[model samples]
Target: MNFADISSDIRHNQIIELLLQNNNLSAAKIAAILNISSRSVEKHLAKLKQDKIIIRQGSKKYGT
Candidate 1:
């Protein structure tokens, strides 16, 4: 499949995968997964939230 044909959200599934890896993740965590800026990840996450493709299980301290 052409990644380019997919929506931005699908492209960021790696971030969601990262979130699954931790069960709960912060902006910083997803940023690390995609190697992108946290600000970009935040935008991706916001879109995902509206799409109901991800859920928050509460926040955790980074490196905690």
Candidate 2:
């Protein structure tokens, strides 16, 4: 499959994988690990939340 066809899924998968490895990672950290922008990470995260694929459990400052 071409990258253009699966790029969004790839990003979502990367985020899920990173969260699985360490659920406490911040969006910025995920972005750093994935070498993407934080905004992009946030977008994926929002989508995941809408799909009920992931959940946030704590405060933004010091929660996971």
Best by lDDT: 2
lDDT by residue (1-64, candidate 2, tens digit) is: 8886499888899899999999989989999998999999999999999999998887878877
How many residue pairs collide in each prediction?
0, 0
The C-alpha stretches of model 2 lying farther than 4 A from their native spots are: 1-5
Tens-place lDDT per residue, model 1, 1-64, is: 5665476747578777777677557787778767889998888877887888876554444331
Model 2 clashing residue pairs (backbone):
none
| Collision count of model 1 | 0
RMSD of each: 4.1, 2.1
In terms of lDDT, model 1 sits at 0.72
How does model 2 fare in lDDT?
0.90
In model 1, the runs with Cα more than 4 Å from the true position are 1-7, 58-64
Q: Scored by CA lDDT, what does every candidate get?
A: 0.72, 0.90
Best by TM-score: 2
